[model samples]
Target chain A: MTTQQLHEQILQKKSFLCVGLDPDLNKIPQHLLETEDPIFEFNKTIIDATHDLTVGYKPNTAFFEAYGIKGWVSLQKTISYINEKFPEIFTIADAKRGDIGNTSSMYAKAFFEDLNFDSVTVAPYMGKDSVEPFLAFENKHTIMLALTSNEGAFDFQTLETNGKELYKQVLETSKTWKNSHNLMYVVGATKAEYFTEIRKIVPDSFLLVPGIGAQGGSLSEVCKYGMNDKVGLLVNSARAIIYASNGTDFAEKAREEALKVQQEMKEIINSKF
Target chain B: MTTQQLHEQILQKKSFLCVGLDPDLNKIPQHLLETEDPIFEFNKTIIDATHDLTVGYKPNTAFFEAYGIKGWVSLQKTISYINEKFPEIFTIADAKRGDIGNTSSMYAKAFFEDLNFDSVTVAPYMGKDSVEPFLAFENKHTIMLALTSNEGAFDFQTLETNGKELYKQVLETSKTWKNSHNLMYVVGATKAEYFTEIRKIVPDSFLLVPGIGAQGGSLSEVCKYGMNDKVGLLVNSARAIIYASNGTDFAEKAREEALKVQQEMKEIINSKF
Candidate 1:
């Protein structure tokens, strides 16, 4: 989906909340383990429960991948389910994939074409050539990692380079790449203050914020500093919502968690826009 | 496999040549396209032909991922074929994956446990927590991207940071992480001179060098500056070796190309050790 379509969905739903589908077999309800495809079943229920409350579903590819070929199958089913059931919902393949130019093209094809995710997260360490391939796809978004929510974000991202943080350099340099209009960014919600600086570089670009809920990032703080006129912030909440209750009411409980975030997001949008 | 075993295999084979299994459907012989699993069939023939000449096999994951579920099945079969047939050969999943601590563990588990690769390449844009989980795996290696082979490497990796290059800081900081002995690095062979400086921070670590044949990096230049007592390098050549022929003689032609690189590697090992 295009950013404009995503913005329209945000306005229509009165929510910019992106539910993270990071289903872990060990963490899912014990009863679901008997099912043929537990991961997909879990995700299906979550999507069924929370689809209307959220504008997007960001599936962390790592969780599915950890299960092997079976995992890939479950992942395929999950994405297909989302697309077929909720075409308007933005799909983010939180794969964090990037490589050399030709290789990166293969990745772009895998996530954007094969799996049909609206956007895929990518690491910016490989630079322009690695990313431009993803950008080449019109309407498909390439969410490049600017400043991650993890502790490791400080390792290289925060390093001072040419009188500015490396991530700022990444944001500025990325704006110059070919087909950069399709670019979005992965800016962590853990550092809400950084959004002020991040917005300066890519003022209109969407920011997929991950770190709220279980990661201890404040929704209010992120909205205060990060939200734009289009509400260009996809604040993701994974564990806190998905694994809310490991019982039969897991999906219901997940909706409860999602509804809380959606309610907050609705308030933010109503007050701002 | 342990680095010691990898070094021993390099000695026994008389070549540290890592045959990069980046099988592209468009490039593989037309005859194989008619097969049940063309990617696996292509990889099997290549492995059968060159297993004796090369000490390691590095499968670039993007090539497999591009095909979706079928691609992952091919990858599983290819890796399984190698482990069962040639148990001693070191396997590198050139996935270039890294994420948050927990997520990185999932990736490490996927590659090291599920995929059963001896090592996996990772992007070091994220800091210590992102990589340490990969290092936590016993006897498995995590090859973090230091300086890549592509032109984009110059964008962020070579940028000045903390009075040293970002790549240098990556190498130095990586050494301090827990179980760092399992750590290796992806140092592209495009700029051979960078090896001399990389060695200062990580003299003993095995460096998986790409950009050898197709990307115009010199093996001799890399060996001169990068090699140590363990002959610490797995020089990869994918397209130049694998795509040597597009006819029925493809496997034979690939073997011939691998032999040429193997012979060059043999000469380097003989001169040094």
Candidate 2:
């Protein structure tokens, strides 16, 4: 999807919520286990119940990978479900994949062409060659890891690099690369203050914000600092939305949880812009 | 496989050669594509031909993922073939994956358990929790990205952070993690001198050195600075060895190329130790 298309979806939904479709067998509803594909079933229902309320859906690849070949099939099916049904909904293959130039081109092909995701998250450790391949895919987004919402983010991201924080330098240096206009960034919502500094570097670029709800960052605080005139933020809530309940009402409960976030997002959007 | 087992394999093979199995459909011989599964067929022949010459087999995951589900199945078959036929070879899934704590656990399960790779490469941008899960698996290894061989490595890795390079900080901070013992690192062979500094932080750790032939890193220089008492390096050469020839004698040619590297390694080992 184009940035303009995503922006229109945000306006139409009155929210920038991206429900993370991270399915785990240990956490899904018991009844679904009887089905041939429990993971896809759970995701199908959740997407059905809440597709309109959110602008994006992120299926983290690791969760699917854990189950092996069948898990990969489930991932493919879930993505196909989204693209076929909710074509307007932005999709992210939350693969956290990056490698050398040639290897990275394969990853871009897997997510953008083969799986047909609108975007794929990439790690920044490999630098421009790893990132530029993903960017080379027309209109497909490459969300590079910046200040993540984990304790590990402090390990290298926050450390000062060349008179600035490493993450800040990542934010600055990436803009000069080829096809960097296709870049979006993954900035965790855990630290509201980081958003203030982050927005200063790349004010126009959309930031895919995870770590709200389950990770406990205020949506209002994230918006107060991170939101731009274009409403440049995708606040992701995974566990608190998807696994809201393990009962048969799992998807409905997920919708209810997502509804609460979407409603809050509606309020935040109306007030800000 | 345990680190001790890897050390033993290096001793027995008299080579720290890691043959990178990165089979591209466009690059493989025309005859292989006529088979039921070309990628696996190519990998099977290569493994059969070069099993004794190398101690490690690093299958970069991006190549397989590009082919979609069939590719995933092919990957499963290739790894299974290796485990059954060449049980002594240390397998490295060159999938540079890392995420938040819970998500990372799934990746750990995917590579270490589901696929049964001996080690998997991880991007360290997410910090401690992202890496710890991979280390949690018994006898499995997590090869963290340090200074990489690609041009992109200079983007953020070399940027000085807190008085040290970001990659250096990744090396230093990671040493304090829960399973530091299970950790190895990816130090590109391109800059052999970097090994002098990397060894200071991770003197005992095994370094998975890539960029030997295809990316142009000298093996002899890599060994001079990177080798330790146990020969502390799994120097990888993928395209130069595997794509040595696209003829009917492809695997034999691959074996010949591998033999050359193995011979060089044999000399390096004899001279160093």
Q: Best DockQ goes to which candidate?
A: 2
TM-score of chain A of 2: 0.99
- The C-alpha stretches of model 2 lying farther than 4 A from their native spots are none
lDDT of 2 at B20: 93
Question: Per-residue CA lDDT of candidate 2, range B1-273, in tens?
Answer: 889999988988888899898989999999888999999999999999999999989999999999999999999999999999889999999999999999999999999999999999998999999999999988999999999999989988888777878888889989999989999999998899999999989999999999999899998788888888888899999999999999899999999999999998898887766
* Native-referenced DockQ of model 1: 0.90
For candidate 1, the TM-score is 0.99
Instruction: After the best TM-score superposition of candidate 1, give how far the Cα of residue A97 lies from its true spot, in angstroms.
Output: 0.6
Candidate 2 has an fnat equal to 0.95
Task: Compute the interface RMSD for each candidate structure.
Answer: 0.7, 0.7
TM-score of chain B of 2: 0.99
Residue B59 of model 2: what lDDT? 93
CAPRI grade of model 1: high
Candidate 2 DockQ vs. native:
0.92
